[model samples]
Target: MKQRLNLNLVISMSCYSSLYKPSLFHTTTNADIKAYLVGKLQTCKDLTSATLTHSKAIISGLSYDTFTTNHLINCYLRLLRIDHAHKLFDQMSQRNVVSWTSLMAGYVSHGQPIVALRLFHQMQASLVLPNEFTFATLINACSILANIDIGRRFHALIEIMGFGCNLVVCSSLIDMYGKCNLVDEARLIFDSMCIRNVVSWTSMITTYAQNAIGHYALQLFREFNHLRLDKPNHFMLCSVISACASLGKLGSGKITHGVVIRRGHDANDVIATTLVDMYAKCGCVHYSTKVFRRIQNPSVIPYTSMIVGAAKYGLGTLSLQLFEEMVDRRIKPNDVTFVGALHACSHSGLVDKGLEILDSMNVKYGVMPDAKHYTCIADMLGRVGRIEEAYQLAKSVQVERDGYALLWGTLLSASRLHGRVDIAVEASKRLIESNQQVAGAYVTLSNTYALAGDWENAHNLRSEMKRTGIQKEPGSSWIEIKESTYLFHAGDISNCNQRSEMLSLLRELEERMKEKGYVGGTTGVVFLDVEEEAKVEIMSLHSEKLALAFGLINTPKGVTIRIMKNLRMCRDCHETFKLISDIVERDFIVRDVNRFHHFNNGLCTCGDFW
Candidate 1:
């Protein structure tokens, strides 16, 4: 109260009489002096400069000037001195909307979004209405919070306040809805906009990309290009690259790389990190390495992406090598970084190394193991035929239901592979009764029963799944040839333009494979009471095989074929790829739900463990 009352007299030179003095000033020079102080406060790039200018402002009696005070608050915020900024804010005698909004933004930026929300309530109580920037900052706070209920309330408030069409607020709403996984709601906001800029497009595209709807993201990007609204900015390009990685569109990914180079965004570390992940997900880890190597100063993100990428293709040594190098560089590894290291250890049969990394995660790096890291550890144990140990670890992880199901699912997958039906049953049973109802565990357990000739159990599990409305995710495989993606599903070529030729090529490959002692793995087939011949035929037409056939027919011999599958590659397909690779003298890379398998010369990079 005292500070607020004193602010009025601050401009009166009589009040500043330290011991006895009041000084006279020229009106033009005094105004010029105040304006110059405000400008210096506005432009202070660091705390030292900002504090120095602030001292000068106080000596010049500009500290209590509302305009100058607002600039100082913003400067302190830019320097991340949120405490100082808020102190100044509370001391302000008169605060306009800019004053409130700037402080709220600082809170949001500093990750104190609840504090920002409280500030909003106080601002409203003060009869200060929010502007577009204020709404934008609040909406961003909701995004970080990921509270859709509160976010929806903000959306309603924006509409109530007639800010529905404001570009900045609308863009923030799109981002908020996207983070909440309400894609259609976000798209509705985007479509209703009268005009859209690069920020709007990037927000919408990022929403689609991050939500696993990459096809829609690609469609949006194509539309953006058709309209030629603006050159795709860094964030927009990064999202598109991520979409390409998900779809395994190497050719389109290459074109995106060209754009990156053309726009000189190739050197940006953030974009480089995204590109590293993109290439790694697209079944091109070597290309990921090339992009990662170009970054002179490596951060945790790029190194983690590189490590996880190498692990995906069973390049465990390289992944661990990168991990050691990262630690030696004094770059602290985050939880995700440790996940990558453990994942590398699991996939490459480095069980001992993986255990070491897991033990050191908390002790050495101070990274507490999360569900993902624990999942990797379970996978490592399961892969080495330690099914009981893996099962016990999964049961002991102390995670939520979803994470519990995930760990058990991994154990079930390993059990099915290792002929441990007892472990699979317990894991599946626990998963079914758990709060998180998932389809993978049920399907894997059913498949295990079928493989072991326990058809009754398989039928019962499927019936239970159907009764509960649990649907197995339909499996699909994609292969890109000449910039166009071709998709296939099990025993289905309904979408293929060259179905006849592809089928003939598949038949020929089977004949050649059979000639080389390759037996159709009908025992691994999940069909109930099916004839052997029928099961063999079904196995021959699996999605990945169809994709591989298409790739072989289209690409030249020895051109490494890449296939992306939405589910884990079955044991039969894994075996078939190994034989077909040697018989046809071509290499194949298949990225399935779990990991990458590189097949060459009658061997898979996974060494048949996967």
Candidate 2:
């Protein structure tokens, strides 16, 4: 009898642990152990009825108990067999908070937030009280739905249930509020927290960054450090780096880069992407490219960020080259990648290239063209003086949301550039009728009327704009000299340091350029130019000239002056700046109206395409 008992024990143990494992008579009695095995068996296709029956030994022992029943339900959930899980949950004589919470978690995990909420309601009706986990699961549903109302109600419910102070629950609340455009409220909750983790810090910083409050985000980052709390993690670093990008603070971005390297978090892909984006946006494309090259496992986010950064910094060729490399690596381009590519083409006036890509947005890439893509194409055409083609392309889009603003604005700008008054006037009228308070459309109409020699209409439009209190944005330009920047605007004499010198130099430059046969293009004249008034209006109060005068007076001899004009550089100014560059024996980079004009030895890189 003893020998017989020993034989049976040996058989069971061999089945449980053998290499060529037999699948029966498993001897575990812990429900945790059995549930774990059942979850594993559900994943293995070859595990048969014999093994499952062995699992049932412990499952059946705990079948009537809510704790074990919840465990069984969770096992089915791991298999996504929610139906079977629900069946077991229903058959139990009792239901507990854990059972409902487990089911809710399963639904949330599977992206069925609505189903999760429905089950929550059912649980509530069943008289099962919710705990911290229950509210956290429901808040997850609200975040997915972007339902602020549901989120608020959940907040109230958590308070009523005394779970509001739960750090996990409050963390999710901050995240939900931020996603729903309630950053202020999110901050209120975040500040009210008794304990905060890295997640809490990262979420708050990200909220401020998303809402265009970069300074506050950075301030928070400093405060986070001052706390001497847990060291900054990858998420916290990325959040603050993104804030630097939005603010265009290259110094802060560089500091963050140093932090990333020092902390050894540079290996994280998310941190890598944010750093690339920050440097790119801060106008340090070289650093951006360098960081991008070092990425060991570059993903779509980093690739897209680098592409966009290159495009925005006027490195259209580099952007396209990297895009080709991305394709060569089999990395798929998303909508953002195409948008950046199209913008590069537009900015560089690569018309044929832009057209090819716009076609491929739907053909090769399967991304339907959004309004932004169409706007980039239209902007490219208009910048290259293809007013009629731009107008036609604008018409062919079949749907126009804000494209009307873009299309008409582009056409009107092209008209102003090439002296196409008729087209400008027609487009401007439609634009004004559609968007009554748009200051740009009003300015375009006034400029068009002036170009058409209709002084009455030009003055009337200006007067109308004034009566409606629609003020045009003041034209300004920034120039970096001696590592600091100075801004200039029309009629601005407020830089007391250079007032007299700037005006005198501007007059001298104008006179010398005039002697070189450069005349102000009276084509911008409205109400018939009587020569003097046209020249005065064209020459003085021009934003580009004001910026140039400031640069000329402030800089040393032979120093290159770079000015960016908020409005298009008039044809006359383009010609005048070329002669000024020659006379001053200095290069001048003027980014105006539409494109870049680099003038040296009396030539523009654009060759007058703009």
Give the Cα-based TM-score of candidate 1 against the true structure.
0.82
Model 2 stretches with alpha carbons more than 4 Å out: 1-131, 137-150, 400-437, 451-455, 469-610
Give residue 483's lDDT in candidate 2 (0 to 100): 33
- lDDT of every predicted structure (CA atoms): 0.70, 0.65
Please tell me which predicted candidate would have the highest lDDT against the true structure. 1
The C-alpha local distance difference test score for the whole of candidate 1 amounts to 0.70
| Best candidate according to TM-score | 1
**Model 2, span 285-341: residue lDDT tens:** 788888899898687778888887777666788889888888899888987788778
Q: Cα deviation in Å at residue 462, candidate 2? A: 3.8
In each prediction, how many residue pairs overlap at the backbone (N, C-alpha, C within less than 3 A)?
Answer: 0, 3
User: TM-score of each candidate?
Assistant: 0.82, 0.69
